[model samples]
Target: MDKLQYDNLYKFLVSLGIVLIVLPVAALVFLFNMEPILISQADYDLLSDFSLQMIATRNKLTSYFISIFPWVAGILTCIGIVVLLIGIFKWVGLQKNLDKKLDAEAAIQTLNLLKMSSAEVAAKIEEEVKETVSIEAPTPPVSSAVNDHSSAMNKYIEIEDLCFNYFTKRYANKYSFERNIRMGKYCYDFIGVSKLNNIDLIVEIKYLKIAAGNSRMIYDVFERVYNSGVNYETIAHRNFKCVVVIVTPKEELPRLENIVETYCKAHRENASRIEIKCMAEESL
Candidate 1:
């Protein structure tokens, strides 16, 4: 059931239980504590045989009912208490599950919004660059590889800027850009701490322009991410993890996935602590 339905059901069960117990509990308390009044010997002797016989029959029936009343009340009270407890525990568990689900949904929504914002920023930058190039005189043609490399480098810088902006806003006081932490021989692009969750984050941003045959960029960055993750774990001696965000064209995702799978397979232990996410350049 949905949370609201479950909530209503919980309230119903609690109300029903309380209703069930009220009368039985009151009866038990009053009936069990009550004393039977006895007639005096003189009054008993004055009774006719016929009257006495009728009185004896009536008393026998009353005694039998009185003996059974307390047991009935006790059983009903127990059942009511059990139902009440069940309703309470069910309500508690339902609330906990809803909280977790809400948290997960919120996290996903935030990531999606970040992606959309980054995409808009990248598009604006590309438009400005195109306009500037159109105004300038035609320059000499550079080699395909060099031109590709330069374009890829510029894209990486843009991605880095977007990520930096995102982390500053997201992590606020805990995030740093190009933090100089001596993790062996390498330094990561960003570092942050989650004080609430007790986790340290190492973030790496890369733009793999492999769709135009610049595959080496992804491999080199992946290796660096792996090495940094290992070193951070070794030196920091605490809860630490690595996040690698790669921006590439959608056409190259299969090849990227294969490379990532192979690399992670070879370094299984560290791979568990390293999270690699690929974003389509078109989607920013």
Candidate 2:
């Protein structure tokens, strides 16, 4: 497991070993010296009789134990040392892996930030030029078919109230009253659209009762979008796309799957143009 757990286990084993070795040897020493606190009157009488009977014996019970004590102590000490070494080794290995992961994540984040900043700068320059130079610029015509399609897509608004409700309920006890409050809704789904030279996208939140089925549909949508010549980077930067996310009880998966599948197929063309994904309740 973790370094803390390993270190704690090692410490516990070392403590146990010390107690086992020291307590037994200390007891033997007290018994040999006939320490009053070490033995009761009954025990002393029994030992006296045993000593008399064993007068011809070359070894005493305490003496035998004392001779073996060093070996026992040495074995326990070695075991404790080995356990500690193993814990240290595991801790070092985990730390190295964690560091590598963190460094890679940091590099990725920096690259993404730079890309976004560059796009923003380009957009700003385009806006400035349009405002400064307007010499009878040809009026851009809007297509009626495109307008109708955009309106139809906009009509299918995804409700995100359920997701907000789930999170608020999930974290109620952990947050304060004010902190626990949720605004209108939390959205995490996006809709995709394709134009001649540019793509339009809309982001909305939708709730799905069947999370696994929804996840599969999301994968299908991503595949369709990718195949439709839409790159992930364009989708990420486009503002016309909307995400539809749905939240429902996890147990409703079986009943909700059919309904979700039906909806996905009915809007297959529109859905194909978009990418979808699910975040589990636990993740939220």
| Residue 118 accuracy (lDDT) in model 1 | 45
Residue-by-residue lDDT tens digits, candidate 2, 8-76? 554444455445445555665775687323556787677766674664253465567678877876776
Candidate 1 regions off by >4 Å?
A: 1-7, 30-65, 101-207, 211-255, 274-284
Best by TM-score: 1
Least accurate 10 contiguous residues by lDDT in model 1: 131-140
User: lDDT per residue, candidate 1, 1-284, as tens digits?
Assistant: 12223337776676666766886767657767878657899999998999899888988977887889778778777887888888778878777766655544443343333332445445534543443233231352565645744574476567777777776776765432343234546555665644334356878776555533334444556666767766755655535577887666789777777777776887687567678887776764
Candidate 1 local lDDT, residue 282: 70
lDDT of 2 at 147: 61
CA lDDT, every prediction?
Answer: 0.62, 0.42
Clash pairs, candidate 1, are none
